[model samples]
Target: MRIRKKIWNNDAEPIIAIMVVLMVLGTINVFSSSFVLGTTDYENPYHFLRRHVLVMLAGLVLFFAFRKINYRRWRPLQGPLMLAVIGATFLSLVGVLVIGTEVNGAKRWLFGAQPAELAKLVSLMLAASTLSARIKRGKANSLFNVCNMKYGLIVVMAVLIELEPDMGTAAIVLGVPVIMAVVAGMSFKYVLGLGGFLALLILILVNVQPYRMARLKVWFDPWADAQGMGYQTVQSLSTIGSGGFWGMGLGEGVSKYEYLPEAHTDFAFAIFSQEHGYMGAFLVFLLLALLVLFCVRIANRAPDEFGQMLATGIMVLIAGQAIANIMMVGGLLPVVGVPLPFISYGGSSLMVSMVAMGMLLNICDHGRNAGGEFPKGEAKVTKSKDNKVHLKLVK
Candidate 1:
C-alpha cells in the first residue's frame, strides 16, 4: 500500500497566528487611540485599555470553547439556535428602543454590550443552516422556496438592526446570508431581484435619516463641511495623509488625541494607518484577505453542507466588516460605524468574532481529519462527451 503525500498543511496555524497578531496590535492601538478619551471622559488613562483587556479575555474564552465543539453539531441544534437567537435579538432591539443606552443618537447597546453584534453571528448560523439543508435536500433549485426558507429570519434580524440604526451591521447581517445563499445555489434572477429591493430600501432608509444623508454628503465632499458634518471624515483622511507611505510611528499619531471621533471604534483603521502608515494598513488588509481565502478553502473541504455554509458565512461576516471599515476610514465609502474585525475595541464585536473564528477553526480541524475531502470518499475527475469535467465520488 502507498500513502499519499499531504498537499496542504494545517489551515489553523496561519489563522491563529494572524488572529493573535491582530489582538496584540489591537490592544496597542486601542491604548494609543483611546488614551486621551479615557483620561478626559473617565479621568483614567487606562479606562478603555482595561475594558479592552477584559473583552479580549472574554473573546479568548469563547474562541477556545467553540474550538472544542464539532462544527457538525450545529446542524442538529439549528432550529433551537434560530429561535433563541431571534428571541434574544428581538428582545434586545426592543429593549434598546425602550430603555437601552443612547450614545451619539443611536440606541445600540444593552447590558453593556451590543446585541447587534451578536445578531450578525446568529443570523449567519441560521442562514448557513437553512441554505445548506436546502442544498442537501435538493431544494436549492427552487429560488422562491429557498429565499422564503433562508431569508425570512435574516430579513427579520436585518430589519431590527437597521431600526437600531446600525446600518453597517445591518448590511453585514443581510449581506453575508445573501452571499451564502448564492454560494449554496440560489438562482441569479432571485438574487438580482432581492438585491434591487434591498438597495432601494437602503436608499429610502438613508434619505429618511438626516444623519445618514449627511454622511452621504460628506462622502462626496468631505471638505465642504470640514468643521461640521464632515469633521470625522476630514480628520480621518488628514491622519492617513499625514502618515505618508509609512506611518509616523507607533503611539506617535496626534489625531487620536482630539481630532478624530470614534477613533477607537469605527475609525480605528485611520488611527492604525496614522501610527503604522499605509504599509501597515496594507498588511492588515492582506491578513484579512488571507483569512477569507483560508475560510473558502475550508468550506470546499468541509465534511458536510452545514460545515461548508458555516465556514463561508463566517468568512463573509469577518471579511465584509473589514472591507467596510477600511473603505470608510479611507474615505472611499461613507462612514458606517463598522469596526475592523479583530482590531476594533468593542466587547460584543470582539467576542462574537472570536466565536465565529473558533467555529471556522473547528471546521478546518474536521476537514483535516476527514483527509481533506468531504463525504469520507475519494473524488475522481472525469471528462464527459461534452468535454466538461465531472467529479465522481468513489467509496
Candidate 2:
C-alpha cells in the first residue's frame, strides 16, 4: 500500500470543520440538557457533562487515529475483522439479554455500551469488502451470488438487535447494507422484492407488539393520551413549539426539568430546538445535510469501488439516523430510540459516528492523492452483446 506524505489537505478540511462544530455544539447542549437529571440522579450537576466530555475526548482520539491510517489497510484483514465483529456482536446481543442493563423497559445496553452501534460500522465494512470483491471477480452479475455471507451476517445481526427489541437500530443495520448492495449494482426488481418483504416484516412486528402498535397510534395523535402513552411526544412537541423563532435562549428552556424523557439522548434535538429555536435547529440540519453531501462527493471521487462503497455506506448510516431522530422528535414519525448523530449524549453512538467520519476523511484523502491510476483489481462495468452487465477487472 502506498502512503501519503500529507494527511491534512483542503479536501478534508470541510468535513473536519463540520465534525468539530457538531462536537462542540453537542458538548454544550448535552450539559444544558442533562444538568438537572445529573443533579437529581447522581447528586452532582456535572455528572453527565463530565461523562460526555470524557467520551468526546475518547471519540476524538479514534477520529484522528482512523484519519491517519490508510483506509485500504482493512481490505487485507476483511475476513478476520468480519468474523471477529460477528462473534462480538452475537455475544454482546445475547449477553445483553441475559445480563444487560434495562433502561426504559428495554435491554439494549450491555456493559454500558450498545453493541448494535458497533455492528453498523462492521456490517458496512463487510458489505463494501464483499461487494467490491464480487465486482472484481464479475460475480456481482447475479442477485443470488451478490447476496452472500455478508448479507446473511447483516440479517443475523438485525435479528439479534430486534431481539434486543430495538427496532430502529435493527432497521438501520439491515437497511444500509441493502442500500450499499444497490449501489454495487443489484437489480431493481430484487430491491423491490426485498422492500416488500421488509415492509411486511415491519407490519407484522408492529401488530404483534402492543407497544409498537400504541406508538403508531400515538404518532398519529399524541394528544389522545398526553399524560400516558403519548406523554413524551406531547412534551416534545410543546418543547419545540415553545422555542418559536428565536428560541427560549440556551439554558432557559423548561422541558428538560422532567417533562420530556430521554431529553439528552433520543430527544436531544428537541431540547436543542427549545434552547436555540428554529434558527438553531435549521443550522444543525444544514450542517448535517452538508456532511451527507460531502460524503457523497467523496464516494463519487473515490479511487476504487471499495472506497466508493465504504464512503456511500457511511453517508447513508449517518444521514438515515439523523433524519429518523429529528422526525421522531418532531412527531412526524413514530418515536423510536434513535439518537441524533454526534449531538446525542451516548458514548457508544458518538464513538462509532466519529470513527466512521474518520474513515470517510481517509477516503477523501485517498481520492485526492490518486491522480489517474487506480489500485490493482479496480472493477469496471461492461455490457455484453446480449445486454447482460459484466464486470471487467482493470489490473
Model 2 ranges with Cα > 4 A deviation: 1-8, 76-82, 137-142, 369-395
**TM-scores across all candidates?**
0.90, 0.89
lDDT minimum window of 10 residues, candidate 1: 369-378
Q: Which 10-residue span in candidate 2 carries the lowest summed lDDT?
A: 368-377
- The superposed Cα distance between candidate 2 and the true structure at residue 88, in angstroms, equals 2.3
- Model 2, position 159, has a per-residue lDDT of 88
Pairs of residues at least 3 apart in sequence or in different chains that clash in candidate 2: none
Residue 320 displacement in candidate 1 (angstroms): 0.3
Instruction: Write model 2 residue lDDT over 1-38, tens digit each, in one string.
Output: 99878543555688888988999999999999999999
| TM-score of predicted structure 2 | 0.89
Q: Give one digit per residue, the lDDT tens place, for model 1 in 180-289.
A: 77877777788788678879988998998888898897789999999998888899999999988988999899998888999998888899999999899888888888
lDDT of 2 at 346: 95
